[model samples]
Target: MERKWTFLTSHLTSLNASTRPLNGQTAIVTGASRGIGAAIAVGLARAGAHVVVNYRQNAEMAESVAAICRRHDVRVLTVQADVSNAADVSRLVETTSAHFGAPSILVNNAGVAHTGLLLDMTEEEWDSIMTANLKAPFLCTKAVLPHMIARQYGRIINLSSIWGLAGGSCEVAYSASKGGVIALTKALAKEMGLSGITVNAVAPGAIQTDMLGHLSDEDLAMLAEETPVGRLGTAEDVANAVQFLALPSSSFVTGQVLSPNGGYIT
Candidate 1:
């Protein structure tokens, strides 16, 4: 399904609304030290949900994000965990619960993208992408399902990529991992639907992020020319889509991949 976006001009005015759906809830955002993940963590906090910013490295950046959330008067914590490691994921969830409460909102935004021709890629390269982009979501999702099932409400949003749908010219492994994420989202949504847990994927197209560092100026220009929106997407652009999917208003939506591609593909 197409992702719906509600654009707000400024943060100050947006937070003035009387009703906040996630005011008392807690959200855990993986890989939230920078880029899209950090944007999402801060957005959730602004909506009044306590936030756990999970990072594998970059403790300083994670703490900075947590501090931003604290300034919003929302509780924030930083946990170091590699989502691809089952043991670390378990500890991550436990720490989140102990600090705030069982997090009903989970943003599976942690991922790695490798650039190379499929023929030139090594097995280790393939494994690394799969573990972080696919297995990590599985491990983290499993860690949180029980609490969500007990409470009978939860939102699981995985960050996918337009590359997963259209396939990139030289990024076979990255594309495959995100494709698995889309499949996982669909299957798990059905499994968790009866329990009031909604699972969805957000596929972003050509977003301006550090991961796009490999793209030359010409490549970016070509992408901008290709997108109907006439510009490359920003981290905040993807974060807004995530905020919508995490809301109670999206309860009826699940088993869906919402592509925020700016008409790059239809």
Candidate 2:
């Protein structure tokens, strides 16, 4: 038998307290195997959307996230795609469209980070960072846009970084890539506004994830002290902001960057 999943429009009417605003809509989260991407996928599922968890290589972790969503009695699909590759991105979007309907929400969360001084960084290292962080979102955005335009309803959220706004030493390439993401978000939002598609970016500060483990304890402490919140931000914190942006009520808010940085750059 062919598998069938609920589409967003029809699911809205059947929504209960457990599954509200997003009833029956489909959401695709890239790099959802862990960290912020995992959090966003789970958030969308809890909000009543069938979620597609896209991962590059971490199948086990991705499957775990999908199982968690399934426990909520919602459908979750796992897809593997290197978003920076055009062919993979094409297959990813096509599979998603076949499994669910045209995805109403697309979260461009796939990215790679590298820490090294400009002089020490090799050309290969720089290229990898740029391709994953910058090119990936561009390709994924292009892949989903056609469906969005046809439906005349869509939400696209790009994951940026606080460092993208305020450059960080030893992370020049990562910062540049995220900066490109912010610019992409703004420009695309303007171009697609007439089609009822809203595009935005979120810049997050120091968040509690495996990525933070690489930092020295003293560095982490300093970051906490610098933050007005006096603590590290959680993946949940960023996820919440994304949830709000993905809502239909946020239709009027587009082309803006929501920084969940706890006043770190202000």
For each candidate in the order shown, give its overall lDDT on alpha carbons.
0.91, 0.91
lDDT of 1 at 206: 87
Each model's backbone clash number? 0, 2
Q: Model 1 clash pairs?
A: none
- Displacement of the residue 47 alpha carbon in candidate 1, Å: 0.8
Candidate 1: stretches off by over 4 Å: 1-19
Residue 148, candidate 1: alpha-carbon lDDT: 96
**Candidate 1 residue-wise lDDT at 29:** 98
In candidate 1 the C-alpha lDDT for residue 238 amounts to 92
